[model samples]
Target: MRELTTDGLLDAVRAWVVIESPTNDAEGVNRVADHAGTLLRGIGASIERMPGRDGYGDILVGRVAGEVNGPGLLLLGHMDTVHQRGVFGYRVEGDRAYGPGIYDMKGGNAMAVAALQHLHATGRRPRLPISVMMIPDEEVGSPSSRAAIEAEALRHRAALVFEPSGEGGKFTVGRHGIARWHLRTEGRPAHAGAYHAEGRSAVREMAHHILALESLTDHPRNFYVNIGIINGGTHENMVPAECSAICYALVPTAAEEAELRAAIHALPQHDPDVRTAVTAGLGRPPFAKTPAIQALYNYAAMLAAEAGLPSAGERVAGGGSDGNFTGALGVPTLDGLGVIGGGPHTREEYIELACLVPRTRMLARLFETLGPGVAGL
Candidate 1:
């Protein structure tokens, strides 16, 4: 089997990182999408550019027909990163590439592109149809592209998510589901010094709820709830009338998710004098580990072993990705297939240069082996 060279893959990675495609910057993401479309078109695949939802960014879909008829595979990636323009810029040091989205997903996108390019160049045909779906809002929980992801996954037999590998180049077999909530408390405002007895403090009421929410974590079962952002109070001397907070909860199973939701919805306002309200809902469902996923991971482990890599497969209970959407639909899905690196969404985020070639080659091999001409789906 022909493998992509380090230099060739690095060149693609550099080109992708140079294009700033932050989630909020529609124009920047669109530019990246345009460039990606050109590459896919050159591969003899039919390309489609779906209009951005509500002026967010465009979704790019490229399809390659197989020589024989079979079930199709969906390869997914995102063009958007979490970094803003000046906050994070692309830089390459010896053996490591640092940038906003380089490790988290631009690298993965590049890997996908390079894999298809190699397949096209080498005239390799898979046993099944192949489709590449590149969206622009995965970093933000796929608000705009979740529906498209689901639709595409439903059309395919399986999905491969390129969300970046775990530390040390390990691919993910499962990821926690996430729920984001915003809670607001209302209370009567009065002078703190003169009418303290007459006023109700929303801030105090929210504090009680925060403590209750924090108690939901069950580390043994990998269920966790964290209150990440909180804001309240206008002035120190005045009784606070309103408090707002944003929190997140993670569950590893569907039953656990339902239980967490019920708990969240059941939380009551502690202060009798204050009015409390909560707007809570599922942000993303947990990508539970299923038998189909185990089969896929087994296949991936075999491939990794064949490539002379370690075969110790492990599951983690942190972070959410677009895979959550597809996995929730009962599709066989594998995630963290991008470059190996750590510190995503932080200043130290970077990708290991040494891992680029091998990871890209692995993905390319998987694509070629599973593409449209393959029979058993």
Candidate 2:
């Protein structure tokens, strides 16, 4: 039951925030991965860097072995931010660290590392094996890391996701599964002035689909659908031949996912003048609040209470994380076990300086309490 000092944890946060790890920027993300590897190695964890796609950043895996072997616990976080170069400038004002990825992820990464460091310094061993997999591209739906995440989850008993805690440091028990797709419509092009009657407008066809897509939200099952981006018509004078749009849907459960997908696919292609096509599938399966997950949350809450910290039962809602990937495998998963903060994707994103230390201590205490053999297989 050793305590982690606030000053040391703050220093780690400062050091981590200085590195900008935007998701689309491979070089910058890799730089953060390098730094993470160094820190993990120093904490006596074995390290491995898995190469990503040709132009993507690498995934860092750190492992701390225990005396007995069973299903390990996976710690997940992303090194990528949504900010572009020179945007969402980084700064530290007093105890608050303001930056692009501060609250959304980088802060969580720091907390996870600090917890491991605390354990190492005190020569404490966990009851179960612990493995940390820090991947890039979560900000963009984890296109590159989904397979690896699922594989690791299948090999482990449970997973802890370090996406920023809810607005008030509440652990997330469930998150919405997401599906993103592109819609395209095609029509014959003709000169508006000379043969307006001969041509059909693809843009008009797309508009109809957009309206239909919006209607999917009418259901009260917590389904959300949005046509976020639309582009069509090269010039104003001539009738456009093609138009396209990108849309996203969020579902709260697996059954809801199937229902939504069927509805989206069944969208009427009623425009005889234009041909429409829809592409949609599961982006991430919904992470529901199952009984096994409740057990993990109860265990963590008990440890937090013993450590003189606020303890509440698991919270569930619609939001996606790497937890979705793991939960898809039926492995128990818990998310938002990081510092509490808000403004995730805005310039105002920040983490409370006060919660950093206590949250880290909470994580450390959980580690000690769950030390090998405490929870039998």
Candidate 3:
């Protein structure tokens, strides 16, 4: 067996972590893309930079040739995070390496880099070519990059998503489909002190919508609706003329997704005096674990055992990833192959330091062997 260390890998992860690339920040995300592109270019990966649209950063596409030229392995990851600038400090404490995006994905991305570098340095190459796609607005919904990812996924036989792994070395083999709904209510505004009777409150309408929306959550059925953000009103002295609520739904199956979509779009207006509008934003399609996915996991697990890493389990996660798009398209997809960690979108985000080398070896092994002739992809 070959030996590997994470000294350089940790540095690479830290390099990405120090940059604050929230989904809404184009400049920061572009900087991260630039750094990742340069690193991939160093690895002899052909680089293509797409300008970000709809207020997002550029998408970086890097491809490395393989021993053969057939369908390749697609590596999907996002540089955008939910954390804003300087959301938290970065440090290495014991086995936990803390940083804003490190645990969420920078760690996993760095692992991919380390694996490729190891393969390059060792004069080894995978049977199939590899394409690493860096998305800019995945945290929001991949609105700009979805088309590109789907296009690239169709060109590959398999896709490996670099989303953060769960606690205890768990990976996401499947993910629920996510759909975002934006609700807005327009009502008559009047003076609270004098014209209270004439005023129709938009907030009241939105509150009712929230209740109606939340009532759709059914844990047994694995359907969840979350109204995460809301904004309404100007001042307490005047009635709110407009209110908007942004929420998302998680559906485990395609049938449930259809039903949920109908439900969200057909939400009733509790206030007859106000005008209500609903905008259903397309979200990531669900990534269901098929027999093929299970077989892929079995192979990856066998490789992990060969590499002396922990026997990591796979799950159908509720969170969404770029894999949702590819997996839904019948392209074999394996997700959550990033660093093992628990906290995401929180200040306590950290990745297990010990899992670095072994996981990278596992990824490299997957890269080194999986292909049309070598493995079933």
Clash number by candidate, in order: 12, 6, 0
Output the TM-score of candidate 2: 0.94
lDDT of 3 by residue, 78-156 (tens): 9988999976889999888999889778888888877888888888887689999999998888889889999999999
Residue range 196-264, candidate 2, lDDT tens digits: 888899998888889987787845778888899999998898898899998888877777678767776
Off by over 4 Å in 1: 1-3, 371-376
Runs in model 2 lying further than 4 Å from the true structure: 1-3, 371-377
Stretches of candidate 3 exceeding 4 Å from the true structure = 1-3, 373-375
Number of residue pairs clashing in candidate 1, backbone atoms closer than 3 angstroms, sequence gap of 3 or more or interchain: 12
